[model samples]
Target: MDALGIAVIVAVLVVATTIGLWHRRTDGMIRDEAADKKRRAAILAAAGVETVEFPDRKSSNAVASAAAKAASGAAAAAVHGNDTVRAANAAARSAAAGVPAAPDLPADSGIAVPVDSGVPAPAGPVDEAASAEPAGADPQLAEPGVPGVREPGDVAAERKSGVVPDSREEPGVVEAAARDASAAGESLDQGLLDRLGIGPAQATLLQFSSAFCAPCRAVRRISGEVAELLPGVQHVEVDAESHLAEVRELNIWRTPTLLILDAGGQVVKRATGVPSKPQLIAALGDVLPDA
Candidate 1:
């Protein structure tokens, strides 16, 4: 062929190659971005705070239909003397009613069932204090040594001065009263955790983070490492945006807010910024066993 024709053909080949390379590079970048997003989603799920997408009407209807079918099957089997099916039916009904289901005791289980009452007898000792408390009176507010309430020291001084004190006020008791107040607070915290579906751990380090916060990533790493080093310690990272209610309840006004919970799920300590590894370990020491 002619020299000019050969040169023109060569230029066309170079242009085509350049366009193909650019297209492939763009495709690779898109794939990489998608993969990174999926990896982050998996990490958040592992941290016990998953990003949930709102289901469309079709998907919601399908899920509801499936649940209804399962419930129907369980109810049908329950009529056939199947204990498991009976338990499932009860649980489904309770879930529909938005209440906790009663525990399903096996027929041969040694636990005694009260006659004339379909419920089992109480397994533990009754709380005398709860029984004695007057109706509509908050046990927590009634307790001494609590803020805005009568302090134990004041009660003692009043008793020594021959002033008649309230029956709930335990005069001459300070340390025990303080301990009781602390215990009451711990009990309330534990109950809150239970309602949130958080099980007991030796220590739970809850890190609240935002999507655009860079320091939050560092705190997550540090908290995860600390949890691994300490047995029975759990590390949970919550997305502050997704859990705004929890953020407001816990008074979290910043990203990378760390809440260190004791075994009883009580907030033992809290830090706002990124805490160093050593500082975190020191805080954990207070809640760790034998510390």
Candidate 2:
């Protein structure tokens, strides 16, 4: 053979060997599903659970319903609390500056009267001072430097600005970074569970597999064993070919991707390939019932 042909053969062999080594090195290891925070956040957001908590609160409802209710309740409460804080701050600013704060108009009286309307405008300013509480009425909204009022740079303004404090940096939030990332977002709903012939449990071993993948059967066996051994846990196997939409939406790139979901159907961890029973149990520690 010509030297050029031999060199071409050598190059092909080298590339093939390199690819094989890379795949073998990572075949069955449990690792973070997404490569970066942004990707992980995107996955969670796509799953309709951007801020649901982990195994801390278990649920038997379908993953979607539980996660949606939790996210809705949390958002409503936060918005309500922030609005209250803003109203209080406005009142405090007016009191400190000796300005008359406008009285709240009733909901039904919100229609604006046109300038040429026959209705007559009020002749004088409202006597807010007569009906409203005096300055420093609520100790919590008193001016800065008071005994209990928050200073100028407190988190009240941060909350008002819609700046969410980093969940990881928040007090009492430390854990293995990978585990924490897994816990952040990604949930499945009840309807999907029903369609897949699975029911809700405290924790779910959700396996995505295809017909031709030999290792997928092993993963199924391991997941089933884990589910049987662990109370409140269920094993659910899905044929990736049959559920192409879910497979694509979830970014399931491999034949045997297993999603470890908490009781509320929030995905707390994910792994691809066949996993040892011990490793599966360890991955489930966060959602497992307390012994």
Point to the candidate with the largest lDDT.
2
Per-residue C-alpha lDDT of model 2 across residues 46-153, encoded as one tens digit per residue: 999864322312223232232222222222222222222332343334345542222221111101111112132232311231112211122222211111112444
Q: Per-residue lDDT tens digits of candidate 1, residues 1-291?
A: 699999999999999999988755542111111123345556997999967532212222222222222222222222222232223433334344432221221111101110111232232312232222211012111111111112345334434543211213432122111111111111223334544456657668878889999989889998899999988789988888987777776767988788776553445466776777887887677556553
- Inter-residue clash pairs, candidate 2: 64-189
Misplaced by over 4 Å in model 2 are: 32-182
lDDT of 1 at 131: 26
Q: What's the true lDDT of residue 290 in model 2?
A: 52
| TM-score of every candidate relative to the true structure | 0.38, 0.51
